[model samples]
Target: MQKRILGVVGSPRKNGNTDILVSRVLAGASSVGALIKLIRLGDLDITECDGCHVCWQGEHCAKKDDMEELYREIIQSDGIVLGTPVYWYGPTALMKGFIDRLVFFNSPLHRGLIRGKSLMVVIPFEETDMNTVKPVIDFFDRCFTFLEMKLVEKLVVPGVSRKGEVVTKSEKWLREAFESGQKLGSGLT
Candidate 1:
């Protein structure tokens, strides 16, 4: 069976910079014969974590929602590409909530599911300053480290504010994103 790559778009605007970059990455992965699936969080009903430590005790999350299915996808994927736009110098709330619910994977019972899996992060920001995306990258860095996941690549596209600007304005970064996906796919094989 072909390896699976899951792309999660945390941008609120469909077909925006973040989504386009993610699609480019997934396209590259597909070119390498990897099965690719993209999920837009803006279209889902994922809720925030209630600060309940039940998952830490090897129990399930207290709430029932789209994340149950997302968890399954995450488990099935050989690689995951997380795409998000910067908001207030950090990842969007949608992305943050998704990350929050990832506490389920923190439990020793489920930690192994994520260990050694390939991860790619695609971040698109409006500001010209690269520092604008630092917090977002840092958060993912910390999370991936704690989860024992290998962060294969980070495609950060700065100075992109409008929808599809990344595509219209920068061929270099777009090529980089595709290359990162190729790397992720080839690495898995």
Candidate 2:
């Protein structure tokens, strides 16, 4: 069966560094014949989790919005690439909100549904120091741990603040991102 990989972009900026990297990863995955889908959180009208606990009772969220569609896509996907720009030493608000809605899957009633899936995190930061991206990495690590997903890889690009800067500063990183996607698509990571 062909593997289905989903790329979720959390950056509000369209075609920004995060989006570009995620697109490159998906392109790599496509090269290896894996089916790919890219979803931009900024385009969706996802609301914050209201702590309604409805998912625990019904095995699904009660809110009627774009998240419902995302939930289905995530459940069907064999692998996921989460791309986000670092904001204030953490994931952007869009990323956090999307993750918060993932709480539905964390309920005991729905545990293990997403287990064994592969996950890759792509973070682009403006800071020259790599340490600035640590918190974002750690956040994803903990999240994948809880979801029982395999963290296949993490691609961090630093010192990219301006638009389209990634294309200029480091073509090497872009190549690496593509390679990582190929690995993920081939199930080698």
lDDT of each: 0.89, 0.93
Query: Judged by lDDT against the true structure, how good is candidate 2?
Result: 0.93
Q: How accurate is candidate 1 locally (lDDT)?
A: 0.89
Candidate 1: segments with Cα more than 4 A from true spot = none
- How many residue pairs of model 2 clash at the backbone? 0
Structure candidate 2, residue pairs in collision: none
How much is the lDDT of residue 61 in candidate 2?
A: 93
Query: For this target, which candidate reaches the highest TM-score against the unseen true structure?
Result: 2
* Best model per lDDT: 2
Query: Count of backbone clashes for each model?
Result: 0, 0
lDDT of 1 by residue, 1-189 (tens): 578899999999999999999999998988898899999999999989988878777657777889988999999999999999999988999999999999899888789888999999999888888888899999999999999998878888888888898878969988988888877766652
lDDT of 2 by residue, 1-189 (tens): 688999999999999999999999999999999999999999999999999999998867989999999998998988899999999999999999999998998887776778889999999999989889999999999988988889989999999999879999989989999999999888887
